[model samples]
Target: MKLYSYFRSSSAYRVRIALNHKQIPYEYIPVHLLKDGGEQKTSAYGKINSKHEVPVLEDKNVRLSQSVAIFLYLDRANLNNPLFPKAFPDFEKCFELVELINSGIQPLQNLAVLKKLKKDFEINDEQKVQWIKDIIRNGLLAYSKKISDEGPYSMGTELTAADMFLIPQLYNAHRYEIDFTGLEKLLQIERTCLMLDSFKTAHPDIQPDSV
Candidate 1:
């Protein structure tokens, strides 16, 4: 198995946490996104993932994109620890968290959007930061209310793809200097993730290409 990843990408970070949680060993092929004005845009990497995104997983001669799908695939292939709930309702609840992260938080604050604001809209740094904060604040606030019923983790005690998604978004929050205090449940979730080794090892600072 192999993971084509960028060190600072939140999406890639999500998959890294999942791999670590399952104790799945794979070779890491670093795709330096910033060098030469983002390597993910190069023709070479684009052929592997038409979407031109990081965290593409190649296993059993199958190349997969999207972090949640990759997590489910690895969980099924390894069959060691279950990342998603098996019971019908419980499983749906887990997926609810995944949707909240994937659809809610990720799209608004991704690097591509940030860059577009600067390049296309000519938004200054402060404005860009404010835009990011506004979007993330709304999404996280709603998530805090919705996921309140769950335990320390996103959906329950067990770590799911949602938790994997949360840590990286929180890191993005910190990167933008966004204040998370308004979202208490999110703060609790981030605190809990900090205590886990999977998040620790997958952090951008420890990655090979991180500055």
Candidate 2:
């Protein structure tokens, strides 16, 4: 298996956490997102994923892109530690949280989007930071409210896909200095998630590609 990844990419980070959680071994192929005008845009990588994105997982005959889809694929393939909770409400709730982070929040604050905002609108660095902070703040506040108070993990006792998604977004939150002022529940979950070996090993700073 080969994982085309960038060290600081939150989407890639989510997939890495899931892979580590599942105890799957794969070769990490670093695609430097910012060096030489983004290596992902190169023709060589285009052959792998025409969309030109990181977190492309190539295993046997299956080649997958998009972190959410890749995560679900991995979870389905390895059933030992299920990414989704086994019950009714918790299972649905896990999906809800995953959608919140994966769809609602992550896309708006992605590197490409941020770069586009600057390139297209002439948004300065300070303004870009403010933009990211505003979006993350509103999204996280809503997420904090939705998360149950019973959690050391997002969906309660078991660590689910929602936790995998949340931790990386929190890493982004800290990276861009997004104000996590009143998000106690979210912060608590993040703290707990980081203590685990899976999350620790998947952190961006410790990755081989991180500079």
Best-fitting candidate, scored by lDDT: 2
Candidate 1, superposed: residue stretches over 4 Å from native: none
Q: Write the per-residue lDDT of candidate 1 for residues 98-207, one digit (tens) a residue.
A: 78878888887787888998999999988988998877777777777767456788876777777787788878878877777767777788899988898898888988
* Model 2 residue 139 CA deviation in Å: 0.9
lDDT of each: 0.83, 0.89
TM-score of model 1 relative to the true fold?
0.93
Stretches of candidate 2 exceeding 4 Å from the true structure = none
lDDT minimum window of 10 residues, candidate 2: 148-157
- Deviation of model 2 at 166, angstroms: 0.4
Which of the numbered candidates is closest to the native, going by highest TM-score? 2
Clashing pairs in 1: none
TM-score of every prediction relative to native: 0.93, 0.96
